[model samples]
Target: MMSKEDKIYLELEDREFPFSYTDHDRKIVRAIVFDEEKKFYFVRIHRDDSFGKATLIETSGGGVEKGEDLETAIQRELKEELGAEVEILQEIGIVSDYYNHVHRHNINHYFLCKVRSFGEKNLMPYEIRDFHMESLKLSYEEAIREYEKCSNTKLGRLIAQREVPVLEEVKKMLLIN
Candidate 1:
């Protein structure tokens, strides 16, 4: 059980699928980013890996580096992954889930942000070859449909369980739904 006090909560949220991981802990960040036009950005990835090419769409951001604050890590991740400069307007709390297949646990912090500007994306090496990604700005209805499409696959189900609620929460907060 996670409360507001613990910096690193060693627990998991009740999930649709039981989540567990080999690694004890990791911290990550993601942003629900909106541009001036009101469309949100989601990364559509074609993952070429041992399992073959699998398509997935996910909100952007990544692991928090040691010694980095949450705000800085998120900013850096957005710049790298989305080529985006953003002003984070609000914190959307956290989500905890396990990747049983990989034996890893993720403590995902989410935020709601407004895009300030666009720059060139700086994806990491593997992100280029293994996960060739394209950022797509979609309307809320389109995002919901994409989530449903993603949930049809095994891995996609897990991602949807972890991320869709964050999207839903933000949608409600913004009164767009």
Candidate 2:
């Protein structure tokens, strides 16, 4: 279980925390876009508000605009973040919790997305300083190893378990021999 301090840190890191208690609550969406070649995973490098430093985060998503469905939010975020369109494969999971001193509540929707092609990456002014599609392929074990290096946050754990249908689907899509 996460301590109150840890939960607060996470909410601040995600920028979901409001300055005042009366601020309107909002939903945020993010995508995990992977290429079939297994060469690169799209990610953003940004300064975490809570951690006070820049870090590479393996997610592409943003706030859910008013009256928008989750899928629409995901698509809009992908285009806004990466300048690329994608076909969402499935909803991997959801993480919901409260961050004391930060957000009253937060629910992050995770999705596995397939990109048609790698295009120019466009970073949103706030969430990203720069972005890239790097060549890093990992087996299930390797993925877990990498995830272990980071704090055991929900996102980290999810990335550790990313070897499931996502990897399998990628292998099938690329026809890796």
Candidate 3:
């Protein structure tokens, strides 16, 4: 049997880029993994010369590694970054955007996930500075309000638009509101 890593690599290697851009389009993915406790996990990335200052962003799971599939990439990313095992429940959606003159092709796959366990979040030394696990007790309205002051990241816009309804659903699931 092929190893999980091998299977993931094969899937990514076989994928072809149907669309092209003048500038190289880098493929990326993100996850919206949540637990039964209604807490959402996010990463606080430290900015450097290439990026900027420290900023809070949604827990993203992606990178078009040679021979990796979308699902495999996400699963790998979740485990790598959060040090947690997650079971993908459903794919929420996808989004693509361009920023800073670079065309970023992000096949953002939002998944309803359950964290089986937690350990020390293993962040890439240069990519992340810290992380936080927040509860959904904060109202959607409150979340939207806080996002506005958060550097106006794409994740913020998603929350403002109520694109990922899992946050709301989780609150309801736990009877928080």
| Best of the candidates, TM-score | 1
Q: Which ranges in model 2 have alpha carbons more than 4 Å from their true place?
A: 1-25, 38-40, 48-50, 128-143, 152-177
In terms of lDDT, the poorest run of 10 residues in model 3 is 6-15
Candidate 3 residue lDDT tens string, 11-126:
11112222345355657766666667555665444343333333444554657688888778887887777777888765544444433323343344445566777776566654
> What tens-digit string does per-residue lDDT give for candidate 1 at 1-177?
344653222344434344453666779998999977679998988875543346788999899999999999999999999999999997777888777655677889888899999999999998988788889899988988898897766567767777777787777777885
Backbone clashes, candidate 3: 4
How much does each candidate deviate from the true structure in C-alpha RMSD? 3.5, 8.3, 9.3
Off by more than 4 A, model 1: 1-21, 50-53
After superposing all C-alphas onto the true structure, candidate 1 shows an RMSD in angstroms of 3.5
Each candidate structure's TM-score, on Cα atoms with residue i matched to residue i, is: 0.87, 0.58, 0.63
TM-score of model 1 vs. true structure: 0.87
Give me the overall lDDT of model 1.
0.81
lDDT score, candidate 3, position 5: 28
Residues 6-91 of candidate 2: C-alpha lDDT, one tens digit per residue:
22112223233333453345476766566664443544343445533333435567678889999999988787667778888877
Candidate 1, 115: how far from true, in Å? 0.3
